[model samples]
Target chain A: MPTIIFNRPDNRSERVDASAGDSVMQVATTHGVDEIVAECGGNAMCATCHVYVDEGWIARLAPMSEEEDELLHGVAAERLPNSRLSCQIKITPELDGLVVRLPDRQI
Target chain B: MSASGFTPSAGVPHMDIDPFSIEFFEDPHPAHEVLREAGPVVWFDKWKVYGVARHAEVHAVLNDPLTFCSSRGVGLSDFAKEKAWRPQSIILEADPPEHARTRAVLSRVLSPTVMKQLRGSFVAAAESRVEALLAKGSFDAIADLAEAYPLSVFPDALGLKPEGRENLLPYASLVFNSFGPPNQLRQDAIERSAPHQAYVAEQCQRENLAPGGFGDCIHARADAGDITAAEAPLLVRSLLSAGLDTTVNGIGAAVYCLARFPDQWARLRSDPTLARNAFEEAVRFESPVQTFFRTTTRDVEISGSRIGEGEKILMFLAAANRDPRRWDRPDEYDVTRKTSGHVGYGSGIHMCVGQLVARLEGEAVLSALAKRVSAIEITGPATRRFNNTLRGLESLPVSIKAA
Candidate 1:
């Protein structure tokens, strides 16, 4: 099991266990986190499931899908170097102990 | 062409594939290819409708309400006395000033600030649901999570007790299905949900809505003479019907896409920030709400196809999302596509008022999952739940081994 830590803007954090083969969005939606939307049902069409990966972890993940990259174009919040869609991210052994920071708000 | 040259069945010449139907919804690329070849708009006589498979025309109709009036209803049924049950969505159906007023009330009541204020409660409820689903390890993403989440959140926020909430799904499903022809699908939904519409309506009454929620707020606006009392319940009804399924379908669609692209799913886990973009990309790719109809308010020329006044014009959003002309490798699900201009939430005045809320719900769920799950993939065959207008999945079975 990968240990996923959610750091909110207020600096509060919740640590949860992410099972292998589970996409980040599914775990969050099923577990009840407040910050991610996973709208478009995790299809990368709504841009609501955005989160900031810990800067250090960016390269460890696979490259962003063409579809996920395109949908990020007009999000209201500023896009950072570590921006990603939770649904696009799937937990793997390599990503075990990964830490993702949540934006203060999704809307 | 030999059978191998094209799809095994349906010898329709030059037909790529039909992704909207169940047989093809899972993998619609072949059908999209055929529609793209046919032209910007192809009249599918079998479905008795024209498909605007190209991106440009689909976007045009989605954005231009004047040419593509929504008053006739966005479904296949004429919404005539024989088939119609509920009234049209004034906010979704009217033009300009009328639409402007109803939308304004909904906006004032369901504003970003208001939704944000409810974040704590929404998050708490979502967490409980997530915990239950996560415990199961393998479950149906649609019924177990997506549909269950919004049905739990919105009604409570609207002040409905748990008992009053039972009708939400059936009512919304029927309302959206009624947009199609009065076929078995429509008939089944009607018969199933018919008994609940009255109860649903009763809950929307001014006296019934719990104070402090959005429903009460609308009633307050009516009292202030900002809007007619007659309009309050209808607007609330609109919120109930449109708000729930849209988010449900949206969430469901994203899950389906992620399952199809393991690389993309892995990318999302590496950096949860991409979750928002991932959702938008899914909508652009699958278009949960596939098509919205409009009656030509007057004579109109759409991409050189003359549409007479009062003629029904169906806008094919799913086709447009995959249109090759407007996108590079359009069929591929790339999160980086410039999807801001996409018409997934529609355009013009009738754009979804509760979009912020929907986005918030999506972000909360995905972000939480990113922090917990290590790997997620489909464990069983995914099934699509068909509705005339809602393009969404019925089941997405995934296997997870917690990290």
Candidate 2:
């Protein structure tokens, strides 16, 4: 099983295991991790699940989708090069030790 | 096309259900249960449309927009087969590449950030409205609180002029009814709504809307080259279509639930913060926007059943909300239950853009009522407001006690 490391802005961290097919949004939500609102329920329509990927893992992640890219522009927090809608990132064998930094806000 | 090119009557469960009838609309649960039990995908010979009532299939179809397209129309009438009565909504009816731009504009405008900005005004309006209605001691919840609350805030927030704002309900009522077959209801709504439709159409323009409102925000995006100038009004129309009846019915459903289920009201009264969860559970228990039909762009298989190109697949969000396979004691309206993933607002890319604001409105009203009203009792039998697509009350006479 792949594990997702959610680094909360409050300086707390939650490392939870995720099913291979589940997205990081689903993992955070299922484990009751805070700060990932996922307001659109993993639809990529709402940017509430915005997260910054660990710089080391950015290249390994799937390219941001057009819809995700569009909504990312409107996220409440400052957009970063590593900023991604966690709902758009699916868990896979290669992403087993993924680290996603939770934004300070996800309004 | 050959019979082999399309879905053949093999393993598909055929149901004799008439989904559009008033009887079905009034109490759809039994019919929904029947649909779900029949199969994951059922073919309704009466309407000659495929139906998916189970959560998995309906969610799957909605998620895969490329295959189950909306551009053909999210209603009984196929736009490809006939001329649409009005301009197709660039956001609602357009496919991905066409839908993306306008949807991006709306998704941004109606995001949680916008909801946070709109929250204060919405709560203030809700507080004032609830207070005024509670003073009546006994009044119609639907007409007095539900419809009145949304009418007071939403249209004003949308930048609609206050005069002739009575036209909003009729205009929106017709829009919902137009989603079904061309029945007497649809025909009557068309006849009764001509003037209101004209007023609503006029309100969609950049000049007609207030300078600093959501409408202007949308047009500003157009000015910024996010979307074309011509697409702005159509996007406004999408907002009007999704925003009005949905919130009204959502609030109405929550109020009705609290009134009918005294224990649940007691629970909410004890913990006012459950107001949001209470509103959501009510939406799941009594789905406001019951059903929407999506057309298949090509031959598609869902849960072992095949539906052909251009065929209408009725995604029963209402049905899916109560599917026994997906919910525990699915019929109960428990305020404390976590009601995420319910299709009360539909799902996927086409999910209700009106949702965030609607949730805020519902939470505001319910929390205000919970804070002040000790008890809510239906003084008279609730009357149903019939729209082909909307499920809400015409009147709910209620008497409340002060906390």
Candidate 3:
């Protein structure tokens, strides 16, 4: 199975196995990754499942859409250039070992 | 609307009991278990509508909003066939694709981010309320903490003029009860809340709300062309309509659960982070917003029983939460239980739009009390306030022991 790494604000990290077809949000929620509150169930209706993609993997992932861009502005944390809604990032085999930082608080 | 021409299949169980009766509301558990065991679809002869009590059926029905539409109204009175008592809720009574647009703007406006911003004020209010209750020594949880906490904070969050803050519960009573059969409960609530409806309508206007509050954020969406300006105020109405009494009842239910189940209280006391989950469990256990109606867009079959087109199916969310088929210990009040799939918040796209708000409010209050108070002892009876659609207490006299 492909895997992803979730780094928390406190400098701790969890490397978890991810299913090939699942979104990063799905993996985060399934593994009970803390503060990954996909409140609107990943409709992009809520921007709670925000993550800061590790720089090296940013270009390797799918580009953000207009909806994701607009929702990013509404996130509680300071939105960075690498900020992405995890629900919009679908996991692919090539994206294994992808790293994303969880926001300190989602709500 | 009456299901006069329609009929249910012989496979569906028939019930003669009134689900709206005060007697049923007072002790609904036995009836709920019977409804769940009866069949997937049970026809309540009193209302002449089908009832879906099992978790699977309720989940499936709510998920397939396309087939079981809300456009006809989410109440016994069908909007398609008869005039509604109020302008049908643009959000609650609406279905996609329009429902999608309105829901998007709403979910955006009241997202977790907004709750983050409101967290400071909400927690402060919760802490202050706890202090007041402690000073009083003994008080009704309903009047003092449950109702008082939300009433103090939510109106300020909405930025409504403080004078008519009292109108929220009456208006909410009218909105929720209107979903049921227009019996004495519905009629009485409607009569008493007429002026209150007018009062709330005025508050929904953009000019009446303070800038940078929940109403303002929604209206900002209108300016950006996400939703119509006309739809903005009504959407704000949606928040007030669903947000108030449901939350008040939710808090009351949590306090009642902790008081009755000492072990659970101890569990919550040991770890304050479980406060949110405790509130969620209480909501699952109590099922505050008891039921909703979904008019069938087409003939539907669930588990083997058939329900016809234009028929009303009362989705018993409370009953579904307790269905033994769903939870490991459906009757037990355990704060640590995983309550993710519970229908207490409803299900599918129309799931409670205000859930994030409810969670924030529930957590703030629960965390505050769990930290300051050691025991929540029931000193007097916890009286059930009967409404056609809501399950809550009118009074819960309790004295707390300081930690």
* Over 4 Å off, model 2: A5-15, A32-37, A47-85, A99-107, B1-8
Q: A16-104 in candidate 2: lDDT tens per residue?
A: 98999998888987788758777567776668788999999999987987767777777889999999998889889889889989988
Error of 1 at B57 (Å): 1.4
* Candidate 1 structure quality by residue, lDDT tens digits, B323-373: 667677877876545465466776556667787677667766665566567
* 10 residues in a row with least lDDT, candidate 2 chain B: B1-10
Error of 1 at A91 (Å): 45
Candidates ranked by lDDT? 3, 2, 1
lDDT of 2 at A18: 92
Each prediction's RMSD to truth:
13.3, 3.0, 3.3
Give the poorly placed runs of model 3, Cα more than 4 Å off. A1-107, B1-3
* Model 2 Cα lDDT, one tens digit per residue, B1-403: 2122344457998888889999898889899999998999888767778899999888888889999889998998889887877788887888898787788888777866677678899999988887887788999999889888998888878887778887777888888999888888888987787797788788889988897678888999999999888888888888787788888899999999999999999999999988987998888999999999898888777877766777888989988999878888899999877566788887888888777788888999999999999999889999898889999999999998889
lDDT score, candidate 2? 0.85
- Fnat by candidate, in order: 0.00, 0.26, 0.17
By TM-score rank, best first, the candidates go 2, 3, 1
Docking class of 2: acceptable
